[model samples]
Target chain A: MNILEVDRVSKQYSGHKALDNVSLSVPEGSVYGLLGPNGAGKTTLIRIINHITAPDSGSVTFDGHALTEADMPHIGYLPEERGLYKKMTVGEQAVFFARLKGLSRSEATVRLREWFDRFGISDWWGRKVEELSKGMAQKVQFIVTVLHRPKLLIFDEPFSGFDPINANLLRDEILRLRDEGSTIIFSTHNMSSVEEICDHITLINRSRNILSGRVDELRSRWADGHYSITFSDADPVTLMEALAPMAGSFSTSADTRGRHTLDLRLLPGATLRDVIARANEASTIHAVNEAVASMNDIFISAVKANGGDTPAPVIS
Target chain B: MSKVSIIIGREYAERVKKKSFIFTTILMPLFMLALMAVPALIVAMGGTETRTVTVVDPDGVVAPQLVDTDNVKFVIATAGTDTVAASADDDATLLFIPQGIVEGDKPLRLVTGKAASMMLENEISSQIERIVEGERMKLYDIDVKSIMAAVESNLSVNTVRTDRDTVGSSTMSYALGFILTFLLYMMLLLYGQMVMTSIIEEKNNRVLEVIVSSVKPTRLMLGKIAGIGLVAVTQIVIWGVLIVGLSAAVMPALLPADVAADITAMNSGAGTLAQSNLDTDLLSALALIADPMYILGIFGILLLFLIGGFLLYAAIYAAIGSAVDNIQDASQLQTVAVLPIILGIVFGMMAATDPVSNISVWTSIIPFTSPMVMMSRIPYGIPTWQIVTSLVVLYATFAACVWVAAKIYRVGIFMYGKKPTFKELIRWARYK
Candidate 1:
């Protein structure tokens, strides 16, 4: 069952359309990824869902009912801009926010403490929010957001300020939430994080959804049947010469271990087996790995194909 | 938690805990004490030394009658090269009584270091005239007995008013009325701004979003107002108790023996006045507040006016906070809100000088300005109808402001990035 359905929602600001007939859905118990570059209307859509702003057209349905003001308490929204009263203590702010989300004081405190302990931040409860580091503040925000356990959770760039370890911890928690039957709509530009956590992805460009599908399906659909080969004593000239006829493009570089390696992007209808055979004919193939396009690659290709210039991908 | 209570509690706690609250609450009384004691101390240090005025009576008629007193020593100088300026420099005020031939044409000149104060000059002139009149009566061989009889035969009239209450007035009543009106006005303004500024700060910091999501906007706004209002009330109660308590505890120790005697004498005089003019029930009521019923009356009127006026202005402040996204924007609106309060205070001060005057009546009737004006008039004995009408209007204005404020609040809290002008706020009020 679909927990949330945003159908052809459009929001205009003066002459500029922030969200142009953008439609998306989150199935029950799924982690949905909203993928877009900067200023691609993801925040606008999230804000619309949160009822901070109204859509210029179309409607949103929650749990098979049309969205209304009453539905606000049932949805938890973690806005991109993290705001907390600097002078208020962590526990106070958390409980205050939780209560707004419909939790009683005792209930909010209990849930907040449990989350605080889980996040290893029980010591921070008495400290002012301004005294916390960005990641610590984000942890408090996360606890507040989930304290009431809303059926649907919307997070916009939730992992932006988290360290890698904390980021992984948040990822695990998000997955756990999904497993516990919470539908999640997360908007982020971190395609790798999306690739790891998102079950479904939507790529919005120029205020419109240009491509969206299951993450794996989208990756597969954008795959070019490429394979990378690594071998000791591999001569780049010989490998290139043997694969020239079948290879659409190829680059050779030495790996960190000083082993010779070759990367190839095959032409359309080319098979991974055909590249492997060509590489095997020239060099002693120590490793033959089929290269599947990462979400980053698919995102770039989708964006590029939809008339957006794909910048050089940065690998971390 | 109930929304309003929670809001009120938060507002109460947050404001009372602030350092500013603690500072003001403690400092105000100390300042007031210094204000009251400084003049009396200066006078005491100056001492009761008399200045000798040598009157050069060339006519020789008025000299013997002008007797010396502790406040002013009169010396009769008989034309022995009188250095008028030198004598004035030594003491001050050398009166020169010219040789007067006629009874009605007596003239005198005075010399002093700097110019003699108007009060001193008037005193000297009156003394000279009394002396000259006595001499003229003696020159006509009019016996003192016959003069006394003739003066006694002249009609002595008593004044009575039918429409006005004959409470008779005092300097203390006027002072009390001014103080009560001023204190209430200051507290309302000082604390109302505090509430408004706190809301604006929270909104600017974006913390209001979190708070508003949990508590309804109305609840949160009211809670803050109530919380701060409670804090203000607490401070006032403490100050009142402290002032009365401290004064009672320290006043006897601070007063000199002579001053205390004078105060006792004054109290006896007041007792006689009270016995003659005030009814027994009114006297008992006056005794309850240490025989300052006018002070208590002014205080009661001030309390009503303060609460009504503060709530009315506070509602406007809350509306301003909601309508504007930042403190800067709210500041622009603050001018308009403060104008009426300022006008009330200024006019109230002026009304204190003449509480029964026409201007005071008009000021007390206008709802916006009435709190201060009515408080000032209470000591001068306002009509019961006027107080009732002022209260009714103030309460109605407060309710209307709250209603309008709620509308602005609902719309304004969600608005960001842009500030609406006065015209825009009017439009927002009319928004469907």
Candidate 2:
């Protein structure tokens, strides 16, 4: 069910390997987060997939066909470095871009009007792009990106210039696009949103794909098999005291909320069932859940493990 | 519409609505009309300055012939000062005629507050010459008509082509050629800079990235180029219609009949081309224009070369635009394109006087200069092979230049902030 697949793609530019042996498969009807630190070659892979630049080696298949110029109409890409013709009116520029993406004149106008009204920017139809504020202009560009309603939508740093309210609005729209069966690929440093919306992700670092999988799988893969237990039995210390015997082999902490958490290092024979069974002997187990890492933690840890030279971008 | 066509339409439609385009389209023709009409108006209105000359005829022989003219009035002074004063009582000239003037020992003297203009001096001298000649004739009793009829002979050279066609006036040919050549040159500068600046502006504005991702780079550049070319052509046609309309109808109406006749005489031949004989020069120029082949050939070559030359230069201009981050970075390479067009203009102007010179012959055939130089030569009747060769060279150069430029432009649009050098552009062109 992959809508787009880029495999073993390598691209070189003036002695720099912009993308090297990168592979990614975006599932249909899912939001795919393309994650990377600065200069991680995410944009390069996006460009290759979009056919903006050709890969030195490897191939990209879109909707079961090799990506080609003919496929451009089916792929909508909103580049990170994007702008509109400033002298052109907002609606005029939007319609022109939609037309470039293979929309008919009447079709482009109709579709663009829908998007403009949805974004509450119908009044900006006759206003030039220069007259719009930065966020307003970005809204115009975002509408343009999705106006053609291609099967595969790619957005690079789409939320960079939007306020939280508009960002959430765009986030809702992006999820809606996914729900409607359009595959989405967007690259950003915002991990919380990535976790919030993305079902799958491909993490690229240092011109290579470091890790990629379903978001839940990736977050759990980076997780330590530790559990935080909250029990309201006769005492929560009973749970801590139960782990006190294996204190030399495990770590334990008790929060003020009578929740006991234990960091367990697995022995060859030890299992989560054993730990739970041991805890049950001392107290009634109210809740037992394994701790999982957030996407931000996984991103930083994965980048750190792979080459680890690049500074981890601060999550805002 | 196809993507390229859509892009072309957008490029054309968006700019055509701009205030700058409308202002230029309307203003340039007016400027051209003013250029052609202002001088003619001044000459027509300059007829009202009249001056009076007082003649002090100490000698009786000079009094009877003193006459008035349109701009000069002569008042015969029966009694006058013995000496001509350094300054006149008014701005008019005062002449003191002494007895020595009838003899060969004295010169006719004129006195005025302001120094005499050569024009006034010539008029006064001619008046004196007429009087002196009359006096001399009366003294010798010789009739002036017999002298002119006896010795003056009219002779003219009529050049007929081997095909039994009469050659037109060389001056008129030069004027027409120079004007057409200048028009080509100006069109190149105007349209060439427009294409270049438009590209740079798009690049700087970063709008190129979105458009290029959707449209092919070559189509985008060509679309923009063609769009601006259409605008340029629209402007030129409008100006052409306006200027031609003004020259053919309005100018004649505004001018006095005699002055208009003078202009027509001057435009044609036989009125005052330093060889006036039955207006043959003017007639031939008019005839050359009237000849279908002449009209077809001049415009044919002009159209061919205009497209060829502009395409060739626009490729270079677009490349220069792409090679930089903005107009400031483009300044250095801009001179490279402009200097050649200028050299072509110089060769075009030089070709009018010395069409057969090595410079004209070479520049007329070179692609960069061919549009202007060949335009000048075509009006003067160039050889068929030369025009064909220049056209071929121009078209070939245009194809090659666009090919190279498209390569650079594709790479340039993706680039940011770097001020690329010529060598870098060459390398970019070399890249896949």
Candidate 3:
């Protein structure tokens, strides 16, 4: 089930359109990735979903109904630029956010204490935010973001400042939240992490959604019809000559042990069996594997293929 | 609890718990007490010293009539006493009336060991001049007593308002009006800037987005202003209770019993100050201060204007703060909010001088200047309808300002990096 759907959302600032007819759906119990280069309107779309800003045109549906003020508590957002009142203590700041999310003071206090203990940050609870290390503050903000257990959680650039250990911790928590049936909209430029956790993604560029789908589906959809093959006791010349007519392109290289590997793309109407049958006539096959595109390659090629002329949205 | 109240609670608690708030609350009354007590202390310490003036009149014409005061003693010098020697005493001054000085061109010569004070000079010169003039009048065979009576009969105007039970001095009213106006002006500026600074801090901290996502920007902005306002009111109330209580305990101790009774009688509108032997100006001032209704009226007008004026200006200030990334960038935008407050003070001064004049009346009725202008006029007993009209306009304008400010603030807080111009702020306000 789709927990949130944005349809034809459009937002215009003074000089430019931040989002142009951008649309996406966040499915329940899945981690949805919002992929875009900086200034590609990912943040704008996130803001619109958070209701921090209104879309110039379009509608947002949350949990089977049009978005309203009452729906705010059901959504949690941690913006890219994390901040807390410097003079406020960590526990007080967290509880304040909880109260703002409609928790009673006692409930907030109890939940905050549990969260603080779980995060191993109870010792830092009474310390002011200004006194906390950057990583520590980010952890506190993370706790504040998920403390209410909102049905939908949006995290923008969630790993920008984390060290490897903490980043892994954050990733684990995010996946855990999804496992518990909370839909998540995660926006970031880190494609590897997206591949690791994101089930679905929408790539936005030039204020428009250029590409979107399930991560595995997109990888397969953009895959070239190429296979990497290794042969033993095979003559490179004979193998190339036999596969040349059936293959679109072919290359061969030898390692230090003098074992040669052949990489080739099949021509139209040629099947894997036909190519393998033809290659077997010339050599003994050792191993054969198909090559699929990584998300990084897809992202670069998709943005570049679209002309890449979209100047970054003026943030101010 | 409502979200706004939660915000308000945090805003208030954070500020009230600060050391600065506590210091300002306790120390402001002490500061004011020091200011009030310094002059009285100086007067009490300096009142006892008496100086003798030796009069060396060659003709002995003006020497007999020169009288002594509590601080100045007039002593007729013996004939053949050296004027310079007689003036050698540290506390004595020698006055020489030349022979035939009543009819001659020689000015009265005063010789003192040190330079005499202006007050002593005026006393001796005036005494000699009066006697000299009387001698001249006798030379003309004129009726000096009848002329003196005629001059003394010149009328002194005593203003009595038909609505007021006792006669009040216009100068006192102007002074009181000016004081109240100045207080409101200061509070509006101070508290309004406070609102702006707090907004800028939240914006700079980048916490505004997190909070705004939970509640409407309007509610957050208003909650902050209200919370700080409660802090301001708390400070004022503490200062008020301290000052009023101190003055109540101190006033009777400072005044003679009879004079205190007269002030109490005048406070009740029973004793006429015109019949008192005391300085009527001082007595009336005391009486006015003693009147509970008058002080309450002043306080009521003050608090009303303070809150109204603060909300009006603070709204604009909040908008300005949200439009910029930092306080440095806010400086230029703040002028728009500051200019009207400054203009209000100018209008207030005008109202103090002439509350009934067209400029004062119009400015007091206009919302932009009414908080200041109306505060200055209220002490002079302006028409009830004008007060109602002014207050209504002030609050209505405040509501409108908050509405527009919230619109601008809602958009401006999300914008980063560039400082928006006023035109941009207006555009932001127009965004749906």
First chain of candidate 2, TM-score? 0.86
Candidate 3 local lDDT, residue A99: 94
Better of 2 and 3 by lDDT: 3
lDDT: which is higher, 1 or 2?
2
Candidate 2 CAPRI-style tier:
medium
lDDT of 3 by residue, B236-353 (tens): 7777777666656775566667777888877777747667766555566666655555776677677887888888898999999888888899999999888988999999999899
Candidate 2 backbone collisions, by pair:
B268-B282, B269-B282
Query: Given candidate 3, what's the lDDT at residue B328?
Result: 93
**TM-score: model 3 vs. ground truth:** 0.87
Top-lDDT candidate index: 3
Kindly indicate the candidate among 1 and 2 with the higher TM-score.
2
Determine which window of 10 residues in candidate 1 chain B has minimal summed lDDT.
Answer: B282-291
- DockQ of all candidates, in order? 0.26, 0.60, 0.66
Q: Count the backbone clashes (under 3 Å) in each candidate.
A: 4, 2, 0
Task: Tell me each candidate's i-RMS in Å.
Answer: 3.1, 1.2, 1.0
2 or 3, which is superior by DockQ? 3
* i-RMSD of model 1 (Å, 1 decimal): 3.1
Tens digits of per-residue lDDT for model 2, A15-51: 7898989888888888889998988898778878877
Best prediction by TM-score = 3
Error of 2 at A247 (Å): 8.5
